[model samples]
Target: MTRSLPALMLGAALVGLSAPAALAQSAPMEMHAMTAAPALNLSAYGEVKVAPDMATITFGVMTEAPTAQAAMADNARRMQEVFAALGRAGIADRDIQTSGLNLSPQYDYVQNEPPKLRGYQASNRVTVNIMDLTKVGTTADAVVSAGVNQIDGIAFGLKDPKAAEDQARVLAVRALQDKARLYAQALGVELGAVRTLNEGGGYQPPQPMPMYAARMQMAESDSTPVAAGQLAVRIDITGTYDLGR
Candidate 1:
């Protein structure tokens, strides 16, 4: 429907059309538009120490001869001696496992050297699981006395890692709590419910210092000095907490 314009002052009409002065008015806060609020995030890690109850020693024998048959025969002889020694040391047949065996021709590599096919080398490796920590030194010595030329590796580890891991987890949680308390106090606010929690995969069992240098000279020693240090477990956790005003 069409209607006639109302009779009004031209100046007043122009003033209405013009924008009004803000009169020192303040802009409403754009809290959502300006920036996001800060979030509380904290993380803590804890570790626990435990003595190792088990040890794994990988020892082997290497023999070389002009012929593969001869090398095999010698390997068998030495391995038998080692087996006897293990038995004497109170190791069960089940605890002793053969991990590797190899026979290969040795080669000499020199510049312009058509690799001289040296004597054939054969090796037999065994894994010894020792339940008693005290026997580690004696067993190593015995294996050497039995003609085991190669001590591949020795590691002291835990028989069960579950309980130790749980204990470390408790320590980690307490550490996170302490951090949250400190943060909340510094911020002058109360730490509220946890919004997020994440745990890093827990600790690995500690291992012995490697004794990789060949000990062929000690094949007939009274006893070798061995040290079994404490095993350590670690825990890590990250947490997010809501803050109360």
Candidate 2:
């Protein structure tokens, strides 16, 4: 049956109005379906302790004289001797690096008086990497005996950190998983697959040990007693896990 023109127009208007009303009624259900699922977020860390295999010692020679030229010359001569001593101690040239060199004028300070020029001082510093742990003590002594008057500090570390870091990473993941499981059980929810995983914190160097000129007390035949204590390698991880009934 053919509809009249006015009836057709009226029907088209009614259909347009009903379409929007139908969409409005379904919007809430669509939004509910799009809601995010329940999830648990957690962070954990792990550590592994192992003995250090290598050491680096930063030591220097300080020389003072009436003139800057004289002070620098004296410093250079003493530093040469120190280098030779290190060579004797089995430290290769590749391991030795000059860290710093400076020349400065010294001042004699007196109460209520202008500063007076005392002399000029020159200093040279070198950092040496010792691969052999047993030679650390004797190496320190050798440098001191050969003209290293000032010992700055000593640091111990691993030659290669990959293995240790990998071990730490495994431990960290296990810890994170265990924590997620525990939380899920306590909440009476089943633990689901990990939604996201993140990793952080690896291989931090140990703090330098404090060393002083006074501590290098030389015995007739004994080397300085250096204790290579254990070092801790750590790893941290964060993970998000899905939670379900």
Candidate 3:
């Protein structure tokens, strides 16, 4: 069937009106999809130094004899004397630990012949934690006098590092915050809450201080001297923040 001219014109007009309404309804949804959260990333580090409160002293007694038994016996006697002296100097038992012990046979090599047994060497080493920094020199002198043939070295350290580490972490966080604010300001964006944070750092133990050779004898007129320097702790942090326009 053929439609009349009036009905045909009315249908065309209704189709034109609905097209604009559909487009208007979809515009806001497209704008909402275009808007997204912006973000900024930053990192920072911090450090702190403090004097060491404790010292570690390592020394050993060595003895040689014709037989392993005799060498061990002599080493044990000298080590006992050293232990007694340490106790007299106010070193606690828990602070003293045996670090090494060995008994080896000395060898004599001859040309075109099998190696001959020369003698036996015995050694006993101990590591002592000296709580009193003032007594470090005195302790070294006393141990040397008590027949300690080997002085490995001395290391200065802290008894507790948690406080220092905590302080460093706080400093790192503050630095990160300041840096983030600077970046946001320069970029012309408002800084929002932290979106992500990560912390990283470590404690580096103090190295051993230089000391004389094991066989060097101490001068009777002067006491042994030691210097315990300061120790440093550090921390680092990485953070991400939301940037608002």
Reference-based TM-score of each model: 0.76, 0.87, 0.77
Candidate 1 or 2, higher lDDT?
2
Native-referenced Cα lDDT, model 3: 0.88
Error of 1 at 157 (Å): 1.5
Worst 10 residues of 2 by lDDT: 211-220
Model 1 scores a TM of 0.76
lDDT of 1 by residue, 127-156 (tens): 999989888888888888889888867788
Score residue 146 of candidate 2 by CA lDDT: 94
What's the C-alpha lDDT at position 166 in model 1?
93
How many backbone clashes are present in model 1? 0
Which RMSD values do the candidates have, in order? 6.5, 3.6, 7.6
Local distance difference test values of all predictions, in order: 0.83, 0.92, 0.88
Residue 105 of candidate 1: its Cα lDDT? 95
User: Residue 51's C-alpha lDDT in candidate 3?
Assistant: 90
Q: Compose the digit string of candidate 3's lDDT tens values, residues 1-245.
A: 26588898999999999999999999999999998788888899878998999999888999999999999999999999999989888899999999999999999999999999999999999999999999898888888788888888889888888898888999899899999999988999899999999988856667666568632456777667677878889998899999997
